[model samples]
Target: MSAAAVPAPLPLSYDDVVKNLEDLPSLPAVVMELLNSIDQEDVDISVLAKKVSNDQALTAKTLRLANSSLYGLQIKVTTIQQAITYLGFQTTRNLITAAAVTGCFAEGRCRGFDHRAFWRHSIATAACAKVLARQMRFNQDYAFTAGLLHDIGRLVLVASFPERYEQALAYRAEHDCFMLDAERAVLGIDHVEAGMALAEHWNFSDTMRLAIGGHHDPEKPGAGFLAAIIHVADAVVHALDLAQAPDGLVPPVSPVAWNALGLDEAVYLQLFRETELQYEEITMALLS
Candidate 1:
């Protein structure tokens, strides 16, 4: 049957969907606590380290990532404090967030979704965004974070509504259509909405939430600078086939988004090379 012939997903209220997702994997307590304490002036490295250290496994994972070649630390970090110090507050916070978020959905649950490949695409998009941000003279850190989480709502849907999500996946496969389109047709709401819901629950910054919500449709009103970066970054990642699902069709770049960056083809070639290099290194460091 043509995917177009597939019946649209029954309308599910956003609140009901959120409630159904309560059983999905959640961010670690330490990560949540750290997020809560992010704004305190005195939430020193020691306090953060102690919280992470409380979870021995999480600390070990964090330390492993800290020492990985991705960070390029000259000296090895032996403790959570040392890792935090070496990586700095903001980078450390981002690392914690990445680890916590990635760890939650590492195990592939929903059929038809390529869990590892999806994360690879996500990391590649983040790498692309960071590189693009550098070329455009924007905040690389924020770009990377937003790029990494841009498609998180898809994960939320797959994890929370496995059976229904599977049906959406089937539609995409049968029709050879974009996953976002399949999701919208089958779920009545796309990953962007689902991701925004989860982002709100997690208290993500407004900038980050906007990026997630507006990544696919950057031309939407109120879409910020970061949203445009991620929008382009996602397209670039797809162009290179860095990481993606089986039917991960590359979407076209928005002219508005492209014009906002003011980058030329030469910059894109550089980004492609950099994304390939960073994607391999970071994926090994974090997932290996």
Candidate 2:
């Protein structure tokens, strides 16, 4: 019949769903400490570097990214401190957080999941979010982090319960339903809900929790401007085929998102165009 008239999908109990998800890994302690330091009123750049250096893999990723063409620096960055200086505190923090989390999904074998492709999609979404935020004069840094981590729960679910997630995917294909709906039907929860729970457990900022929880539901209460930015960015990335798996749903630009950002068709087109051009460079830097 109609979209809304279709039977409402059954979802898992919050306690049951979240209990299995409670142990999802987070960014390393060093990375979390650095993030806390950077977001503080009085940021200590040296302190941030010290924390990053404690994780050798993170330090290497930070240096590799610093020297990548994304920055186009004249000089090489050999030390974590130098990398931090070159990338700036906020950009460095975002990169470190991304690098740490990416490691968790690097080796997993999720049925019907392509880990590399998933990462590419996430990087593209992050790039699009930053571009949109700058054009719309919102918080570019916050948008970038939100978009990068929005689908984090999917990684957790796939890694923890491959059979269940695969069945969810099958249900989506059979019913011509959205992924979230299928996830809810099979697992009694959707990635959005799972993601929000994880984000809360990690003690992310309210803005980040709201953005991740509502990325697919921009009109939901407390979504705010960040949610709208992420919602539009996620759609743009999927439309461009930036992810490993085909996004089953390519939602139209949310009218609420457009109205909230005051983005007319012309401006939206420009943002989309710019994002495509920058996608490769940003992806390489972040994923290197």
Candidate 3:
């Protein structure tokens, strides 16, 4: 049978969808406290580094990242202070947030769900967001955080409702529909909506909430600039096959977003190339 001939998905209600959202592990309290401290203009880097060092895994990751070539460091960073000094306060804090949230999703076996591939896609999308933010002269720090956490709701859904999520994925394939559309058709809401809800629940900034919520639909004027960047970044990542997911789609860029960002075709192409190169270095830094 043709793909279009597949049956429509049965709808599930939001209430019926058991939100194990509360049970999902949150960012470590110390990490959250450090993030709050870093936001302060008078943040004490020495104190922050000492706190980070207490978490053995986070400390190692920070040291490895600090020593990575992504930062172009000439000397090895053997200590937390050195890592903090070398990476800078803002970048170090961002990395800590990224690291803390990386394991929010559970790794499970699904017919076509490639865990590594999903992470690669996510990282590439994040890289694209960061680069695009610089190109468009937006808030790079906020963009990076948004890019990294945009799809967090998908992880929540998969972990919280595996059978239903699997069915939604199957429905997407069977109907040749976009994953987001399929998610909404099968469940009461899509990942973007769920992600927004979760972000709000976590007390994320309005910028973050909008970016994650409107990433798939940048034309929505309510989301402002960050949403537009994430939308384009998501499309670029998919088009470049950075992650090579079996069901990934190369979505179209919103002309409205392009115009608002003041980007022409040439500028977009140039940014894409730069983002691809940066993805390699950033991925290595984070994954190392």
Candidate 4:
């Protein structure tokens, strides 16, 4: 049903939801261990690889990703250690995070949620963000993760309160508005707030927190470069119609985010093309 004649979504307070949001799509422990392992000194790649390989599903996905054109490895690596040896530790960690996050969600109960489309958009945005970061000599892994999970709060809401999220989706379709607007209108909290709460819940790093929490608000006092990068990546992805969102709503680009890129129009055209290429390879690898 279209949003036009839809009844208002049942009310739910953002605070109350956040307070009880502990059970939303828990990340596998391997991700947390890997993240925690990175912060310590003299960490052995073997140990880290073992942690990831322990989960057979995660290992297979991670291996497939390491071989994707997105990683562009020279030789076919058969195992996780070989992957770490060639791609380096940070890239390996990024691979695991991508696999784990993508694997966490069930088929959410929201009937029209378009789970496949949502991930396609997320992967496209992540690819776009990585291109931006590489050109800027910034952290590609952080940008990739942020863009990959930028809309995670929406996933959390869909998983936890499918009926309410369905209402927000209807509202978005009816009004032909941005998802954030429809979400706030119906759910009383948008994904940004929900994402920040989730990020904190998962003990995300500062860059991650900025990416998830400030992607839509890059002008926030401490939003930082990653936030702006994610913001621009998200806009570029949607503007290119990568999301295939029925409403076709592109979020307004923050001027601060847009101007920070300092790239020429020609560069953006290249980025758009490059993003689509990597997205096709990577999404196939991850989602297949």
Candidate 5:
């Protein structure tokens, strides 16, 4: 008999993806507040600190990370309010965001997707992006959060359609191709499409939404530097092998994105060292 034809994935639009987005776990109210306030400098840090302190689990992780050598603090941070007092609002906000985002998803049931590896890679990207931003005089906070969430569309797709995502993973392995190709083939949609949808629904900033939508094509028109930063950060994280998944495939960096940073060899080395040092502490605090 002739080989059976593959069934076509049902037609999926942003609306379809948006409707399924409701099924994914919601971010805590405090996290939502923090994310929306990222661009506003005059936001009440004191109130936000109180809100973070109210969540026992989030508070524990934030303080643990703040007390870790990541900050090299002389004194221990016992509460979110104190952590903010010591680490400043941006750092405290980052810690809370990290804790909340990680806590939102437990282990997933996608057979081919490795959840632990995913978060590790994501954290590594965030660390790498922070290094890049610091070196290049950019906004480290946005860079870090954008890097951390660059692939969140993958999570949304898997969470909303586990079986189809598993098939995409299987297709990826069988063809030894990029996940995006497999996702398009198997699901009729890619994570960028799904992720951009979710970002919009959640009222994330336009820059962040563009980073999600254009990370794979950073050189494209309107991608801007944030997307470029995320793209390069992702490439660096994969090259570092922090995730250490046997099946990991490092995607190529856009030359435009790489050249835009204009970093010399010494700066690259510093970034590698700092990212490696920072990634472990963040992982243990948030992923543990």
Candidate 6:
């Protein structure tokens, strides 16, 4: 028997999608507070630690992650302050955001999305981005956070339109096409827009918004450097089949991004090696 052809995807209301994003669920108060604190002219660690400390569960998780093998700390961290000191202000902020975002999707309602595998891929990509940033002498902490939330829009889509997104996933699986194509074909909008909308709603930095929105297609003139890093890191992860559902298409690396980074083969090999070595520990620490 011949294979059955897939039908066209249903059209979506672009306005409603934007509205849905406008009303997307707000992050926990502490997370929001922390996010705001990092943006201030002068961030006080004591105050930041107090904010985290107020949330007992988050404090504990933060401390545990600080002491986890992923960080390779010599002395155990018993409090949020110690964690802040050891992990550095930006790193601590990244950890808190990672915890908060992971908790946001704790109860995954998306039918086809594998939450655990999805996170595994995210953390691994984060690790890859961080290592790459350090090797290239960029801001490692920011790179890590950007990598972690690179696919936030996909999660948002799954959360808002579970059934439709599931069909999109199914279509991608059947045809072996990229998720971006599948989503655009099925849902009339892709995660990039969804994620960018969410980022804007959340008051994320312009750079972060750019990274989330342009990681897949950084072709526009004057694309953000961080977005370019995320673009390459995302492709590397997919190429290695690190995610639960890696994108079917490994989009070509942007010449502008590649030439700008000026990374050699040795760096790429080292990134893969470091990502492999730290993937499990970092994933465990963050996801546990």
Better lDDT candidate (3, 6): 6
Ranking by lDDT: 4, 5, 1, 6, 2, 3
Q: Model 2: per-residue lDDT, tens digit, 1-288?
A: 556576644555666556876556657887767655644777777876787788888788767766755456899988877776777777777777777777755455556766777788888898899888988788777888898899987886786667788888888889988788888789877788777777776778888888998888889877788989999899888888866466547867788986777777888788777777667776766566
Best by TM-score: 4
Quote the lDDT for 207 in model 1: 85
Clash-forming residue pairs, model 5: none
Q: What pairs collide in candidate 6?
A: none
How much lDDT does each candidate structure score? 0.82, 0.77, 0.74, 0.86, 0.86, 0.79
Candidate 1's C-alpha runs over 4 A off are 1-9
lDDT of 2: 0.77
Write the residue-wise lDDT of candidate 5 on 1-288 in tens digits: 999999876856778899987788898898899888978979988888888888999899888878877678999989887888888888888778877887786576788789998889898998899889888899887788888888888888888888889998999999998888898888888999998988887778898899888889999999989998889888888888998965568898889999998889998898999999999988998888
Per-residue CA lDDT of model 3 for 148-210, tens digit only, reads: 888877776776667778888888899987888888877767888667667766777777888
lDDT of 1 by residue, 1-288 (tens): 545676645666688668866776778877887767656777766776788878776776677767766577999987877876777777777777876787787455787778888889998898899899889899777888898899999898888888888889998989999988898788787898899999988878888999999998899999999999999999989988877458658898999999999988888888899889888877875676
Cα lDDT for residue 176, candidate 5: 91
Deviating ranges (above 4 Å) for candidate 6: 1-10, 22-24, 106-108, 244-249
Model 6 over residues 21-79: C-alpha lDDT tens digits?
Answer: 64556777867767767668776678767877887767766776677666789999888
Best of the two (1, 2) by TM-score: 1
Per-candidate TM-scores read 0.91, 0.86, 0.86, 0.93, 0.93, 0.90
Of the two candidates 1 and 6, the one with more favorable lDDT, higher being better, is 1
Which candidate wins on lDDT?
4
lDDT of 1 at 285: 58
Report lDDT (Cα) of residue 72, candidate 2.
69
RMSD of each: 3.5, 5.4, 4.4, 3.6, 2.2, 3.7
